[model samples]
Structures are given as C-alpha cells and as structure tokens.
Target: MNENKIPEKYTYIILTFTLISIISCIILNAFLFYGFMASIIFSIYLCRKSGFSIIELFNMIKRGLYECKSLFILMALIGAMIPIWMSSGVVPTMLYYGLKYMKGTNFLFSAFILTSVVSIFMGTAFGTISSVGIALLALSKIFGIPNYILLGAIVSGAFIADKSSPISNLFNLTLETVKIAYKEAITSMLKTLLPTCFISASVYYFIGKKYSVVIENSNINNFMYAINSNFTVSPLILLLPLSIIIMLFLGIKMLKSVFLALIAGIVVSIVFQREGFNHIINAILNGYNINTNFVQLNTVLVSGGMISMISVLLIIAGAVSLSSIFQETGLIIPVIKRITSKIKSSEELILKTGLISGALTIISDQSVGIILPGKFLINKYKELKVKNCILARTMADTGTIIAPLIPWNVNSLFIFITTGISTISYAPYAVLCYVSPIITFIFAFLHKFQGRKQTKEIQVKNTIK
Candidate 1:
C-alpha cells in the first residue's frame, strides 16, 4: 500500500463523521464550533493514520489560519462598519427614503424590488427583513395580499443581495475562498441574476394586480414621523455608501474602502446625527441600540458590531482547518477525482456543482455550502479551464440562495423569527430562489449546445481542407 495515499473508505468515514457532527449540533441547538472541532479532531486522527505527524497537522492548521487572517480582519471591519452606519443615521436615512417610495403600486412586485434594493444596501438579509420586510407584511393586510405570497417576494428579494452584494459577508467569503476577483464574479453572476430577477419581477407584477389597495396617507405620515423624529434623515447621509463605491471603482481595495467608510460614518454620526463619542465607540465594539417609542422602527434600527462577527469568523476558521487537512494529506482527493473524472464537459461540471452546492445547503448552512464546494471542486474547475468566477457565481446562486428555502436552515429560521412567515408558506413564492439555479442550468446547457455547433463547424472546415 502507498503510504501517501489515504484509503477511499476513510473519505466516507470523514464525510459521515462530519455530517453526524453538524446534524447533531443543529438538533441540539448548539454552536457549530463544537461540531467543527469534533470533525477536526477526527480528521487529524485519520491523517495520522495516513502517515502525517502531529507537527505536520499543526502546521497545516496554522497555514490555514494564516491564509484567512485577511478575511478575519475584513469580517471584523464589516461588522464595525454596519453598526456605525446605523448609529450615524445613514441606514435610517436610506430606510426613510426607501419607505416613502412605497406609494400606490403593485405591492408584491414593489416588495420584491424594494427589498432587493434595501438588502443590497444593508448587506444583511435579516436586517432587511426585520425592517422593510416586516413593514411590507403589515401593509399586505391593507392591500388584501396573502402574507405568504408577499413574504415569498420579500424573502426572495432579501436574499438577492445576500447572494450578490459586494458588501455581503457571504458574497465576500465565497469570492475569497474561490480566489476570484469581485468584479469578475459580479459580471459572471449577472448572467444568471439578471434573468432570474426579470422573470421574478414579471411574475410578481401580474400577481400583484389582484391586490391593489390605496395606502392611507396617515400610515405613511406615521412612518415619516417615527424616523424623522429619531434621526435626521438627509440626502447627505447617502454620501457614505457612495464614497465606498467611488473608492472601489477607483481601484481601492475593499478593506480600505470599508475603513474609509467607517471613518466617514463616525464623522457623520457626530456632525449630523449628534451621536456622542461613547455611543459611536460602543456601536463599533458592541452594537448600536436605537431608543425609540415606535417598536416597529426600533427593530429595524438596532443591530451590528464587531462582536457579532466572531461566530462567523470561528466557522470560517474551523472550515478552513478541515479543508487544509484534506488538501495536504490527500484524504479527499481520490473521491473528488473519481467524481470529476466522470464530468465530460464544463457545462456538466457546472450543473453538478449547482447540485452539490444545493445539497450542501440543505444539509448545512450557507457558509459551509460555499466553502467546502469551492475548496473541493476548485481543482476540477482549473482543470476544465473554467474561470473560478463561474464556480463562485454558481455556488452563490445555489448554496447561498437555497438556504431560505430549507425549513430547518438558519436562514429560514431567522426569516421566520423576524417576519413570522414560515419557510413552507413563503418558499413557493420565493421565485428567484428557485429561478436562479434553473437559469444557471439553462446557461450551462446552452453553452454546451453552442460548443457542439462550433465543433461541427470546425470539422466541416477540416473536411473542406
């Protein structure tokens, strides 16, 4: 037996071990850290049996952590940046203006579009849902719209940004793991994203026709008063987000751009919002707490802090450690190779990738879904000469968005908690959640057809020659 080769049965054992640990943790409502640790220890034991020493395993873990150091810092910065934006009145201003736009229109379609826009800005599906999503649900009663249908639209829209937004932690994490540039990933994602959005919007537009109801001016007035009374809603506050975009377009790195935005947010909070230094500092380290008489508005305004990011960071570290052993000890390569060897074309590989990602999301959460698939399939992607951006985009399209459709997934649970809409109720209406994967598969098959046509043309030219 080759000392270097890990037995195939070990791969199955490792996977079974990982699955049990994750599922057990989920059922126990325990932090995923415990599950991750158990898998790491089991993998280390398996790696030792395959001839790797303890020192080698330690080095692997260290290298994995070192590679993720920048990601950790970026995550922390994002954590701090969000709360600062909230306390600085930037979020409130955007919320105030975004809410004002919900005047006599197709409620379902408008909910989808508006939530998509806000989710992009906020970069948090939970935040988008708690704020605008809840607001829309309340209005659904007046419009005679089914709460489930409206929620489907809202959940669909909220997750759109979670999957694609530059500021989204998951989006950033996916890109980092796949080693793809942001601009390239976004460009590739748009091929599927635009079509899905268009189709979802059209469906909601016609469906919205049946539930048109005039908004009472008083409801709008109350919303305005609640926001305006607590925070100074100004267009000037929009400059913070714009500044980040301008910097990014100017070739500034995401880290520097976020840092600059955080600084700008601090100044705006002090100058415009009259936030105290202590409050700003507290928001940066802990989280922003908005004190308001309006409970609805209060729910939206509160959230964010560097501390909130620790759980995500821990998960990343654990996943990376697990991935590192697989990479270095040759534990998983055989199984992955066997799988990829059957793939005849890039399109097929893309389709398989979507299936794997969706399956992972069903079994685990979005972070694991993205990280493991990207790590496992990256070599196959490189071998096929397909750009990693496509892989990243595919994972985001399937894994990240599919979470909300899974009833037991954390994403769905959070949505249910925030909006009181169950996954079963809203999932059918979350058209984009399903449409994205279908669009990706279609693109894959379309490319395959195009490739065959080109090959036939080449053969004909050779015959003429």
Candidate 2:
C-alpha cells in the first residue's frame, strides 16, 4: 500500500466500523453530539497510527477553525433569526397564504413549488420540511391525495431550494469550499438546477394528472376565515425578511443579512402582535405560542421563537465541528486522492464524482460528502480542461438533488420525522433527486453543453499560442 493510502483491507474495516458508529448514533438519535465525538475519535486514532502527533492534530484543528469560522457565525445568526421571524408571524403569514393557494391547484406541483420557495426563504430543507411538509401531509390526508406523491414532492422541493438558496448553509459551504464567488456559484448552479426543476415540475404535473380532488370552497373559506380571525396578517410585515434577501442578492455578508432580518423581526413582533413589549419579550425568551380556535392554523402560527432554534443550532454546531475534525485528520484528502486516481477520463471523473457524492450522502452528511469530494475533484477536472461552471453545476446536481433519497441523511430524517413517511416510499417519486445525477452524467459524457474545450484541443491551442 502507498504510504498515504490506507490499505484496501484496512479501508474496508475502517469504513465498516465508522458506519456502525454512525448507525448507532442515528439509532440513539445522538446525531449531533455522539456522532461528532465518534468522528473525532476515529480521525485521531487514524492519524496517530499514521504517525501524526498531538501537536499536528491541534494545528490541523486550528486550521479547520479558521476555515469554518465564517460559516459558523452565519449559522448562529440564522438560527437566532428563526425564532424572531416565527414570533413576528412572518413565516406564518407566508404559510397561511401558501396553504390557501394550494387549496385549488394540482397539489403535487403546488406543494413542490411552494415548499421550494419556503425552503429558499427559510434557508434549510429541515425547516421547510418540518413546517410546510407537515402541513402538506395533513392536507394530503384531508384531501385524500396519495401520501407517497405528496411526500415525494415535498422532499424534491425542499432539497432543491436548500441546494439553491444563498442563505442555505450547504450553498454557503459549497461557495466557500470551492473558493468561488457567490454569484458565480449561483449562476453555475442554475445551469443544471433550472432545467432539472422544469423537468421535475413537468413530472409532478403528469403524476398528479389523474387525481382531481377539489377542496370544497366552504373548506377553503373556513380555513381563510380562521386565519383572518386568529392572527394579524399584513403584507408589510414581510418586508423585513424580504429586505434581508435583497441584501443577499446585492452581495451583502450572510451574517449581516440574517442579523438585520432578526432585528427586523423583533421590531415587527413588538409592534404588531396583540400583546405589547412584555409578550414579545416572553415569546423571544420562551417561544411563540398562539392559542386559536382553528387547530390547524394554530399549529402553523405557534412556532419560531428564540428557544425553538436552540436545539437545531446545537445540532448544526456539533455537525460542523465533526466535519472540521474530519478535514483536519488528512483522512479526507487521502480518500479523495484515492478516489480520483481511478478516473481514466473527464467523463469518468464527472460520473464518479457524482456517484461518490450521491453515495456518501447515505453514509456521511450531505454537504460535507458532496462538497468535500467536489473540491477534491475540481483540480482533476481542470486538468482535463473542464469548465469551472460544469464542475459547480455537477456538484449542485448530485449533491443538493440526492440528499432526500438517503434514509440516514438529515433531509430524509427530518421529512420522516415531520411527515411520518418512509424514505423508501418517497424516494422513487423524488424525480429531481434521481434525474439530476443522470442528467449531469449524460452531459459530461456527451459534452453537449458543458462549454469547455476537450483536453486535446486545449493542449493544441496552448501549443499553437
């Protein structure tokens, strides 16, 4: 075996053991802490056996800290905003109108697009799935739509938004990891995502064509009546978060964007809610609690307060820390090198990277698995004269699009927890998740639209120049 590479037998043993540890963590629902500690321990053990020292480990840890500091801060700020935004009724208002709209159209396509928009707004698949996804499941039950199709649409939409959202941690992480400009990353991602989204919407439209369940106008009237009676709904209230998005589009820092949004939320809640400053303060400290006659609307409104986000924030922090340690141990590098060495051509490189990313989302987390491999593979692609846009597009297509299919991944777990749906049942209908990888692979081999010169042509051009 090469000194840098783990022996194949040992690699298998290590992967098996690590997998067992991960499964245990998931079974115990200790995904945040114990899973993190396990990763750290595994990395340290591997490094020690490879003759790395404690001092080197510490240095690597420091480097990881430096690398992830901005992202960590951004995550914290976004977490803080979740509660305030919730309490201010901004998210609820959005959901209320969103659900109202879904009362008419093809529920599958509507669910997908609505959830996609909400997830992009919320900056997380988990948030979108937990809130809107749960509501969609309930609606499916009420309207007699098949749960599998509803679940599939929800998963597809949330992940697509999560992959594309500028505020999303995964999106931010990818931009940073690839050292690409945010606009550049977004632009590159849209090349693949836009087409996939159109195809996904078309598929959903067809899948839902046979079922026409008209929600009684009385039922829709009652829901709307309940929403109007229970809470204050104002379009102006939305401007706060909308401004934050505008800032993001204008290239403002994510932390600043979230911080401003949180402040805006606080101001809006203090001014708009029935209770005065006292209630606002209590809600911020505890969480928003809305008592209403309409049970469904009550469930929708009574979310998002400071305390509500603590659990998620802690989970994210732990997950990011574990990812940091993984980066530090040189384990990821050796693994990356090993994987890339087997690729014989540019097309093989794209396909293998997409496959590896999709596979790792099953074992490891989504963004880490995808972007880590993506960052590693980029240089190899460049050597083959592949365009950077193609690499970025492929990453989004495979990474963002595939997460919900993995039973153990965060997106799938959140959906399962919130909707009480099986990953296996929903996986087949998550059209974008499966289709994106295939599309990327097809483009890579066909070189039909990648916008890059072939390796030989590039070499010849350089020689002539």
Candidate 3:
C-alpha cells in the first residue's frame, strides 16, 4: 500500500470524527483543547483498529509534533515575553496612555484599532488579546461599557493584523500554499480589506459611543495613579515596540525579534522598574503579578509569562497531531481531486471556499481552516483562471476572521480565557467577523470584471504568439 495516501474507505470515519468535534465543542460548550484531544484519541483508536503496529503510530505522532515545533516555540517565547514586558512596564505603560487617549466614541473604535496594530506586530491573535487586549477590556469595564461591544471590537481588531500582517504565520502559509508572491497577494487583498475595515470601524464608532460610560476625573486620576505606582511609566518604554518593528525592518525573523524584545523588556524592567534578576526569572517561568490594592487596577495591571500559554499550546499540539494524521493517511490529495471535479467556474469555487473556510475552522483549528479547504481548492482556482489572491482573500475572510466567533476554536478560547467573555455573547457585536464574508463574496462577483479583462489580455497575447 502506498503510505502517502489513505484509501477512500477511510473518509467516512474521518468525517465522523470531525462531526463529533463540532458538536461537542459547539453545542455542548466544551473547551476546544479537550475536544481536540478527544479527536486525537479517536485517530489513535482508528490506527489500532486498522491493526497498525505500535511503532508506526508512534512515528506519526513524532512527525506531527515535529511539524509544529516552531509554532509551539513561538508561543512559548511569546508567553515569556508578555510577562517580562508586563513587569518591565511595557503593558502598563501602554494601558496608562491608551486609557488617557481613548475616550467616548473612540473607546470601542480604539479597541479595534489598537488590537489591530498590536496583532499586526505580534502576529498572534491570542497574544494581542492577552496583553494589550487585556488592558483594553479592563478599561471598557471601568467606563461601564458593555462587554458585548468590547468583545466584538477587540476580537475584530485583533484579527486584522493576524490575517494580513507580513509576519503572520497563517498569512505566510496561505501565500506559500497558494503559490503567490506576498507583494502580489497583499496588493490584491488590499482592495477588499480597505473598504471592509472602514465600514466596520464606522459602525463601531456609533456602537462605542452608545456604550461609552462617563467617568469622573477623580476616577481617572486614581486609575492612572495605580498604574504609575506599579511600573515606572514613561515615553522611553515605547522603545521596546519601536525596536521590534526596527528588527523586522532589519530582516530579523519574527521569532528572533520576539526573543530580542523579551530581553529588552527585561532590561528595562531591571533598570527602570527595579525588577531584580530573580523576580524577572520568576515572572518568565511562572507569570507576572502586580497588586495595586484597588480591585480594578489590580485586575488590569497583571498577567504574562510562559506558563500562561501552556493550555493553548496543548490544544495546538493536539490539533497538529490530527492534521498530520490527515496528511499521512494521504486523504488530502484525493480530497482535492474530488473537490476539483465538480467546480466549473471561478465564482462557484470562490463561494464554496468561503463556506468551507468557516466549517473547517469550527471543526479543526485556524491552521486547518486554511490548509484543508485551500488545498482542496488550490488547483481549481488555477484551472478556472481565478487569481490565487482571490483564494487567499476568501480564506482570510472565512477562516482567519471566523476563529474568534466560534467558542471551540483555539483562538476564540484563548480570548475567552483571557478576557472572560464567551464567543456567542459577543459574536453579534463582532461586525467585522460577519462583515468580511459579505465583502469577500461581493468582490468575488466583481472579480469577474477583472477576470474577464485579464482573460482577454491573455487571449490576445496568445494570438500574437
């Protein structure tokens, strides 16, 4: 038997496993990590039922983990970085100033914008929500803003950069799989991105102002005082964020840039915040905690460290292992062939991709969101003369943005655990999440305009030849 491809017979079992995962995670409100782990167990049971030897199964596990080691390492470092930066006063400083600037209609609007900025830089939705996202959530609470509005704003904002940021792993993966240049892909995507972002933000401005809470000057002063006392706040600390962007400019890879940023935060904490070497280490290994006596201040000003990310890491480890099974079973190749058989037009393929993207994210994780559906449809786009950029855009709209809308997706769970808001509770307010698909399909039909033009140009060029 060819080891690379699983026979068509196994497809039924695979579909069943996915169905169980979806129902458990969605309907029953089970944690994503546990649901994923259960799927891993189901996969192993299938291996055993097939009478596979112990050695073969073990090898599959190793291969899967090997594929995701870099991702896990990035999460670990980010986990450590968050805490180190928090103790170093980076998060507190950002919060202190962000609160000062974000008022009234700008509060929710700023949440979306601020998370967008940080997620673009961090390249992880979870990190953005855990760090600065945490601070913004707290501020919304202080202003007596409704959690639904804040949740929607923060989630929508956090994914903006995660989907499009050059450093984003998912974005990079989409480019590699779709066989498009980053410049070419992003240029095409910007056409859809600009309009959607503007409309989403405009609608949010009203929603934000509607929920805006009036705070007394005394309350603001006390809030600022609590943060200032915990960490030595100043403009100089802004260097940490600036340097990270500079590192990216210097061609330093994101993983290394994150490590360097972590070290920089530690140094700043030691020099300015008076964090001793031991305390810094503790925070990195465990988590950073600062108590400001006031309950609101204490809640907002604390969090970070490597251990904080362990649960989500486990979920990814489980998800990646299952992804490997799908690969080794050789299901992907046949799956793609079958999908390509029925799709006759670019419009049909694009619309189907948009639908599959959300379903994949719900059944699997963010990576699976793109890998499963995109790979299935990749070659079809080429045959139909659809720009690969259209494929990438569809994936971003459905897969990337939909992650936080489902409680079972790792990204959404991370946000919920960090901010204590359920995905269902805030999904309506997450205008961008739902709005993206609308714009994506609208442009999908409009794409025929550009497609016709390109096709005509190609035909003329071929006639000349």
Among these predictions, the greatest lDDT belongs to 1
Against the true structure, what is each candidate's TM-score? 0.72, 0.76, 0.85
Clashes of 2: 1
Worst 10 residues of 2 by lDDT: 1-10
* Predictions in order: lDDT: 0.78, 0.66, 0.74
Q: Write the per-residue lDDT of candidate 2 for residues 1-465, one digit (tens) a residue.
A: 123533444444555666777668657756444665575667667656766777876666666556657655554454455556666767666656655665666778888888788777767666566545655665664455788888888888888766778677787676676677778877767767778889999999887765545454335566667766755788787786667657756777666767777777777777775557777677655655567787755554443444444554444455555555454443455656677896767788778777667656655567666567766777887787766666666777886678788665555644554455767789999888887877778778777344445556888999999
85-186: candidate 1 lDDT, tens digit per residue: 788877777667655775667768888998898788767676567546755775665455788999999988999877888778899999999998899999
Give me the runs in candidate 3 sitting further than 4 Å from their true place: 1-9, 25-34, 47-54, 121-127, 213-218, 332-339, 372-376, 417-422, 448-465
Superposition error at 25 for model 1 (Å): 1.6
Which residue pairs overlap in candidate 3's backbone? 5-330, 6-329, 83-305
Question: Against the true structure, candidate 1 has what lDDT?
Answer: 0.78
How far is each candidate from the true structure, as Cα RMSD in Å? 5.7, 5.4, 3.9
Give the per-residue lDDT digits (tens) of candidate 3, residues 1-465.
124335555655765776677567767766566767777777666756666665776687788899778767877887787677678877778768866765444577877887777777766666567556666766765677777778788888888866788877789888887888889888987887888889889988887665555643327777888887777899789788667666765668667877888888888989999988998899888877776677887666555567767777777777677666665555445544565578876777888788777766765667777877677677778787777888998998878888888766667656654555777888888888888889998887877677789889999999999
